[model samples]
Target: MTPGLPMPVPAPGLPARVRIHEVGARDGLQNEQTVIPTEIKAEFVRRLAAAGLDTVEATSFVHPKWVPQLADAERLFPAVRDLAPEVRLPVLVPNERGLDRALTLGADRIAVFGSATESFAKANLNRTVDEALATFAPVVARAKEAGAHVRGYLSMCFGDPWEGPVPVPQVVRVCRALLDQGCDELSLGDTIGVATPGHVTALLTALNEAGVPTDVLGVHFHDTYGQALANTLAALQHGVTTVDASTGGLGGCPYAKSATGNLATEDLVWMLRGLGIETGVDLERLTATSVWMAERLGRPSPSRTVRALSASLGSPDSLDSHKE
Candidate 1:
């Protein structure tokens, strides 16, 4: 662990194995200014899976006007169609149109985005909170009926950029709507990274009280305020076994300038290893992959673990030094 970082306490109820849902390919690259080639994007997903990320979010089917970086989703998905059977590729479907695109491409796993606050719902999806849930209702149902596993993403669950602190009850209601709509799992997103450990506990407690199973919950946090890993530990203590992280902390919210990037996979792996949590991700290979991808992005990774490991190995190019 890095010096001065808080040690993760081993809570009794914590799960033995945690599933790290790699979102670097989709969430991480969506905000990039440069247009990455479709082949490169496909290769990035392959390398992430090679680093032992079993579940990788491939790309979003949203319109090019909304997220142009992921416009090549149609071309990208087919490039990775033959990956190992254990590797599950999920694509983001913003609406019914996006869901239609994903289904046409034969995506077995799809995700929909929703918001807990009215402000974010309006800004992000141009709908009210209730309206956004209503939009996702049939989308989730139709996807589930097609034998596709649907994952629901509730953004701004903890704090919204426009609306200050979001109430736990509001988040629970949206969560229930998604789950009741046939979403197999729900990922609570700290969109602006304003969540703290106490807030995480409070939200999870309320969700549990509302009868939302922890086993079907995942936590997605941004490292904007640098509280993501700490907040993740709180969620795990509360029995959340699934986490969402970007490979090199690659992407941030284009809507929120203050939002930096998603929690770094290497950083999360560092903490999970210290806590003796099994993520099935190889830390060394993960760091190397992030560094390699960072080079392609023409920038250094935002992950402390990636930077530290790169320095320890005497340069980013020396990625093979740590290979077994």
Candidate 2:
């Protein structure tokens, strides 16, 4: 166990055990300009699982033309599928074809992406919001029928880069649509990382009123505005237990140039441990994994926790070399 930071008492209604969904291999690497080797991607997943992450998103089954970096999803899945029986490897499937490929690979867990605003929906999926949801409905149905757990991700929930502020009701409708499609959980995303703690509280409160269960809701925030951790803390206070984070703070939205990486897993673990929340993640191993990944990316980790620990542990080479 890593030494806990001195934290104030956790806010009321926070869950004792939070599930940290590691998304570095899939969501993190997809936006990279340079294509990472398949073997190294596989090793990255292996290292994440070894760091005690129970739910590590392995890869995406989207078309290679859209995300060339993850073109090797077919090969990557099998390589990391058997890393651990308890570790879940959920791949992102954009449509029926993606689902078909994932099913053929014996994937038992998968995720679908949706956007809250029309501009992003069309830009990302080349369809309107309703059309995109319609497309995901069948994919979710097929995955569920095949005994695979399906997670839905709604991007730009807080604000859209193209359309400006996204209304809460609009987000709620999409959330309801995904649940109605039989998704097991929904990961609300701050695609542009423009969300603050207030926005998180408001959106989650609206979802709760709309009958969306917090148990099946996860929060995916970007650190572009450096609010990911604060927003995560707010989500926890509202009874959300699952969180999506990337090791080494990898990933950005290809469509949204201003968007940065997802919240760093090491940073989230540091705060959760300090708050006495059990995540079943080993901070030391997780930090080391981020450093190892940074070396492979030819850049240092964007995680403060990783940098601080690496420096204190006498590995200054792991500090981020790239400017924010």
The TM-scores of all predictions, comma-separated, are: 0.92, 0.93
Superposed model 2: Cα runs more than 4 Å off: 1-12, 253-260, 316-324
Please provide, for model 1 over 72-191, each residue's C-alpha lDDT reduced to its tens digit, 9 standing for 90 to 100.
988999899679899999999988999999999889999999999999999989999899888988899899989999999999999999889999999999999899899999999999
Q: Summarize candidate 2's per-residue lDDT along 1-324 as a digit string, tens digits.
A: 334454636655678999999999998998788889999999999999988999999999999999999999989999989888999999999999999999999999999999999999989888999999999989999999999999999999999998888999999999999999999999999998899999899999999999987898999999988899999999999999999999978886444452347899998998898888888998888888887887877777777887878765556553444353
Highest lDDT against the true fold, candidate: 2
**Which residue window of length 10 is worst by lDDT in model 2?**
315-324
Model 1: residues with Cα > 4 Å off, grouped in runs:
1-11, 253-259, 317-324
Alpha-carbon local distance difference test for all models: 0.88, 0.89
Q: Go through the candidates in order and give the C-alpha RMSD of each one to the true structure.
A: 4.0, 3.2
Q: Candidate 2 local accuracy as lDDT?
A: 0.89
Clashing residue pairs in candidate 1 are none
